[model samples]
Target: MSSVSVNIASKVQLVLRVALILVIFGWILDIPGYFGKYYYTEQLLALVAGLAATITLTDPRWGRTPARATISLVLGLTVFIAFGYVSVRYPSLQLELASAPPGAVALGLLMVLGILEAARRQTGIFLPLLLLALVLFSMFIGPKLPDGFQTRELSFSRLSVYLALDTNALFSKILDIAAITVAPFIVFGFLLNAFGGSAVFSDLAAKLVGKYTGGPAKVSVVGSAAFGMVSGSAVANVVAVGSVSIPMMARAGYARHVAAAIEAVASTGGQLVPPIMGASAFLMAELLEMPYRDVALAAILPSLLFYAALMLAVDFEARRLKIGGTSDRLELPAQNSDAPDKHRWRYLIPVGILIYLLFFANRTAGSAGLWSAISIIAVHLIGPPAQIWHRLQDVWKGLLQSAAAISDIIILASAAGLIIGVLNLTGIAFQITLQMLAISGGDVGIMLLLTAGLSILLGLGMPTVGVYVLLATLAAPALIELGIQPIAAHMYVLYFGMVSMITPPIAIASFAAATVAAVSPWRTSFASLKVGAGVYLVPVAFVTQPELLLDGTLLETATALTRTLMGIGLLTLAAIGHMSRPIPLPVRIIAGLLAVANVLPVSALPQLGMAAVAACSLAILAWAAVPARTTPSLKHENT
Candidate 1:
């Protein structure tokens, strides 16, 4: 704890961060032959980096005592490096490590414990506990379970080795995608943040929507979406944009809880945004063996509908409350300050290039991310710097941030691998699918509802990537088994997985935003649920009609898109209990039912019946939504 030890600990942490970043870059771009040629080596390196970073960043002991912190780092680094070197040097050991030899089992158990500890350190106990429960199930419970859930008996040694040394266990597809694809995008996002991209996004959003009703809230929506496109974490997005937008909304006459809810819900949707959606997108592409671009493209319509619904709610609320214009306390610094207009253009260049390469050139997401990052850094370096020292400091800070971001992703992905490994080993996913089908009586609707419930339960207290990975492995297959389109099924879970961030009882993004807005977390959470209501129905819409996912003819897609958008608008109006006028309770109930009916595919209901019902619903909504006459609409009781 002395000054000298404190300096040494700081230096060690910094060095570890830089090393982690370098390793990620080498693995992503294949600059070093060793990283690209050896998959296990890269995976081991990621594990080591993640553990070191987690201890340095999250462990409280590290801050309290320099000696303990240094010792922890040194020990973690040494064990990981030794294991990695041995694994790399002796490929045959991977198979042998799974055998029942005492030494091998001991090493495997230690590695498994290490991975769980790392996961616990970064995330909460939920995910690590889930994985541990699965391990226990496979060893003790699974073998005894009858019929559908039965599995072969395995001893502790074999189970430990299978999870630790087997390719499918600790280093599975989730880890693969995280390392190869998501890491680069994560780095790019933090890099963008480090170089004033937040200011640029805020300024641009304000200029675009600052004059409209609820302009500040709209800015939060637009800015959060833009930032979410690059970053995957809802909590991180809330922190980055909510700090600015929440206060802006509060200053513009929005209540504290409402402001917090708006930012939380808006930021939560960012993971669903395209180009660089949450890490789930990359994992989906990898699992489906399709291009990442395809996953992103399919997400476009739903994402648009999501933002449109949020914007509409904001507009309607602003009108209802008579709130408008920029706040006197909320001036945009990037626009008003000496920061040149041309400087803002710097933000667009990398984004433009990223889109061009991702969609037009058909480059891999990782490659696109690398080029985009290079473009961003290049522009910053080439531009005039007020001081060389300041530029160096900025670059240094960006590097450390990028390292931390990548490490979080690596750890989450690595931990998720255990879930995948256990399920595959026990064939539990298949058993669960069959059980679900049986319970639902082969009804697709019931099956979807069950799957969604499971998705939410499993996704809670986990990051978007971890949630999607777990659900995709266990729940998504059930939906697919029910004849749902593969993309639709995966996207269904993806939506719910990200939705957990704002879902009540444990909304991480809402908690973070509430802290920033200084509002009650519970109130902000419920408010966010209301703000995000329409989006909650999107997954069901896509499940019922695949056209909503762009999996149909042009005409079919357009018709579905239009109807779905209208359904979303109507549902949102009902949720808010306001349109042009306050809808009566009966009318709101009717509108809500109508919205669901409108979103349902004709196959679910007779085509003629659906059309008639939709028409009636639309007419009723339009009539009820018309503004009431102000003074003499109804005769007074006195009269």
Candidate 2:
């Protein structure tokens, strides 16, 4: 609280911020061949800077007092020195380090503890605990297990070398992908919003869908989808778009919980869409060893189906509530379509460049992202001369913000790298696969359900990135072993992981949106589950048909896609129980059964037969209900 202490804290904060910027910039440019010589240096530098910032950011009650600042500096310096020594000394002394020199082992232990503390700081107890448990299991329990389950016993020196000195543990593939590919995209996403990209896209989305029945909700769906492409985090999506849409929906006469749920589900769906997909799409591509474009292409239809189902549910909700676009009932946000034409068109340039580079130029994802980030800066600088200086300031600030955002992910990915390292070292993934097979009796359906349940559970408390990583390594291999398409299996886990953002008990997205809408988090989360019912079904659909992932013939894909859409339509209606009037319970039940049959991975008997049954059941309900309900004219006059 003293002046000298305050100034010291301020200086430390500034230093950490600068370090963060340099770390991100270094990775993006791989400055002066550092990555080529010592890849771990670049990765470790980012990790260290992220941990430093997190310490400062989460400082004590005094808020970065001298004591806290001193602690942070010491911890950060120690990590930097440890990682620096390991990276610089290891290549030349590979054999010596492998022999368990006191210096190397001690440094490795420090790095491990630092990583564990960083994970605890960023994501809470679940992941760090899981990581520690894995490490303990690998070190102590593995050798005692039955012959089929036991891994080769590792000495302390050997485990330390693998975890800290080699590429197999802490510096594994997932971390490599995260640093080389995902971090750059995270920077690009932050850069887009720092420029005029967000406003431009919001205006464009409003213009495109702001006049529909549930105009504001639909706008949230559209805007969040686009924003999610860049942000790739459901929490970020909710904060960015829901800040505008949640209030707008409430003002348009939606219940507060309904408004919050709508925004929550829509933002969560952003991770399902491509080009950004909250970073999962890129990770999936890397894991599958496929081109990024192929991953995006396969994701296109399922993402569409996700939003299509959302749009319909929103529209039906609007009709059920009789919400409309009258001034008092609902109106477009004022910012939409109000920007000058010249400024608005600039938004498309970066997105167009990104698409061209990703699909046509066939650039590495990191390169594509770096170029896009540069293009965004370029467009901002080239804006109207009067705004250039101000825009330049915004870009500078954006660079710092992007660095801060990238740092957290670097920390997470590195910590997760530890879990992956242990899993590989102890052969735990194989053991898990075998256990899954045993529990499911080799039934693919049972395995899928169990995976879905496990994904949802992990997702409730973990970051989507971590959840996906765990599932991909442990659970997804089981699906692949059962003859599922590789992409289908991966996408299956990815979708369920994202759905956790809107699920009950701990729906992070719903909690965020509910705060914006002033609704109960519990109520909003349950409502999100209801509104996002299709999130649960779509993954199963793709897994069953594979055609939804474009893995089948054109005719077959089209036919399957059509039936699925019809099924989703009826499902939405049944879930909402509104079509002119609320549907009776009996009709709702029939509609539910019909929806399942239509989307079920079965032959013509259930698919066509259920479609016919649902149609008849709906007709009878409509005929009986319509006469008793108020006519449109009467309802309008009454309003």
Candidate 3:
């Protein structure tokens, strides 16, 4: 494409992005509260937003395919609208297969297909494929099937009726969470990123962590964690933070792949972290009818522990190679480097208000987000606040940042909708759960491995949130039935869902990081698995001691927290392959064994063993610290 055409295409894409962001969030938020008490508008809006997302994400290098795009978009909008509108508008008839028209039946299939395509474009094909498998089962399953696998019958009209009327299965609790909390938080993230809230955090992290060892990578982790708290999406975290941190890490002497992978993996961790975990936790609460805090509580330790592992791994690699910090000669820039210091405070105005809302005020997440945005922009634009026009421009830019992630969100909703609808029709969700349970032979460890594999499979072509939400719906029941606490059951699925992101063949985060790092994506992904191995152990940790999830008395929680911290420190050292200077491979392996024992559970022999290994590693490192006569304090390690 010529530069002019490319420029035009870019402009068009940006405009479409902004428009879809507004439509989706507006619909997702259901801002038309009074205007549309009717169900049709809501479903129709969802369809439009989903299609817009697919269109927006298409590689513009192919040029516009207006006819094809519009057809796909409209076909999708029609199906969902008909199902939602008709089912609500004619509920009695929708439930009666004999009374429904052929057009209505066609509409149902369209709704399923349209949603599948939207998901296919925005996420990957896994969800759509899964949804299709179940839908086809509903189409063909006859008598002689297992009890749970058998549905009412296989006629198109009958199947469509089941999908449309079964509100419990299709539109379920996820939509409720989406409307009440998740969507607003998504918008909150977008607005925060667009204006300058994230920029503020970046500037803050650079100042604080950038002066330390492994400064760039550490800064990425710290800044990404802070930013991830509100951003909601992992990939979005990369786009927002990686744009700045990746280049800086490379310039600071880290390999480009390592730099990018650090950002990607760190950003991915955001979905697991609180106060704003990947929109899934909120959905989990809604699904289980549990308190939101319950979800956050369960997630806390595991998130801290994962990042702890990451920090140690990165620090070790940096030290082993003696990668020095950025030349202090190049003085770091100020937070508001391009502007006056006065604007620095303006950025905090919003964040301060958000913190108060999230922590002390104890407001609903949606209300907190809305008010936070209002306060920042409103306070900044008052007569004494600042120039009204200038602040508006800044806020607008900030809002656009939020807009950019819309395509992915819409795709997620439609994809989730498809799975819910299809499985509801075939009763396949229950069957899948039952079969997996039977296969696992009632062992919790075996059940977890099965579900973990399932979660990863689901995650392969979908958003992490979409993946877990579906798995939690289908597979979590088996665990919950086996006496796993509702919270632990959901969290077990969530942990593996996150683990899937780091694992190939999907490895979305690793792939994103690889682009900036200049490392092969596969190699970086393998590195991710080794670094993120701690995550695999954490789900079991929480299950074994819910205290780690803050379920017990404060004292119990404290013990778990302390042990968790110790485990993290030990594991970090083990992962870095050093206690002091580089350890021999055998010693490193020995240290790894001791660290595992230390992290696993407290015991006299294992504790002594841990102490012995750590002490030995520390001693060796201490001796290395005493450099020979004129040798530099640092020495590089060979790869």
Identify the leading candidate in terms of TM-score.
1
Model 3: residues >4 Å from true position, as ranges?
A: 1-99, 141-153, 325-342, 379-387, 393-404, 595-639
- The models' CA-based lDDT, in order, is 0.76, 0.75, 0.64
Instruction: List RMSD in Å for every model shown.
Output: 3.2, 3.8, 5.5
Most lDDT-accurate candidate: 1
C-alpha displacement of 353 in model 2, angstroms? 0.3
Q: Assess candidate 1 and give its lDDT.
A: 0.76
What is the TM-score of each predicted model, taking all chains together?
0.93, 0.90, 0.82
Clashing pairs in 1: none
Q: Could you give candidate 1's per-residue lDDT for residues 1-639 as a string of tens digits?
A: 657666665676677677766666776666656555655553554354344444344333454677666565565565565455444644666556634678767766766666677777778799778887877887888889887669767777777777766768776767767766777787777777777665676667778887888888888788888777777778887887777778778877888898898888888888888888888888999889899889988999889888888888887788778788763222222211233556766777888898999999988888898888888777666555565556566667776877777777877777788778887887776777778888999788898788778766876677878888888877788788778899999999988888888887888889999998888999999998887778887888888878877889999888788778778877888888877788778877877887888788777778788778768777876775678787754467457
Residue range with the least summed lDDT across 10 consecutive positions in model 2: 327-336
Predictions ranked by TM-score, top down? 1, 2, 3
Give the clashing pairs for model 3.
190-402, 194-397, 194-398, 195-398, 256-517, 257-517, 580-621
Per-residue lDDT of candidate 2, residues 171-246 (tens digit): 6676667766777777778877666466666766777878867787887788888888778888877877776777
The number of residue pairs in model 2 that clash at the backbone is 1
Sorting all predicted structures by lDDT, with the top scorer first, yields 1, 2, 3
Show model 2 residue runs off by greater than 4 Å: 1-65, 140-142, 147-152, 155-157, 326-341, 384-386, 602-639
Q: How accurate is candidate 2 locally (lDDT)?
A: 0.75
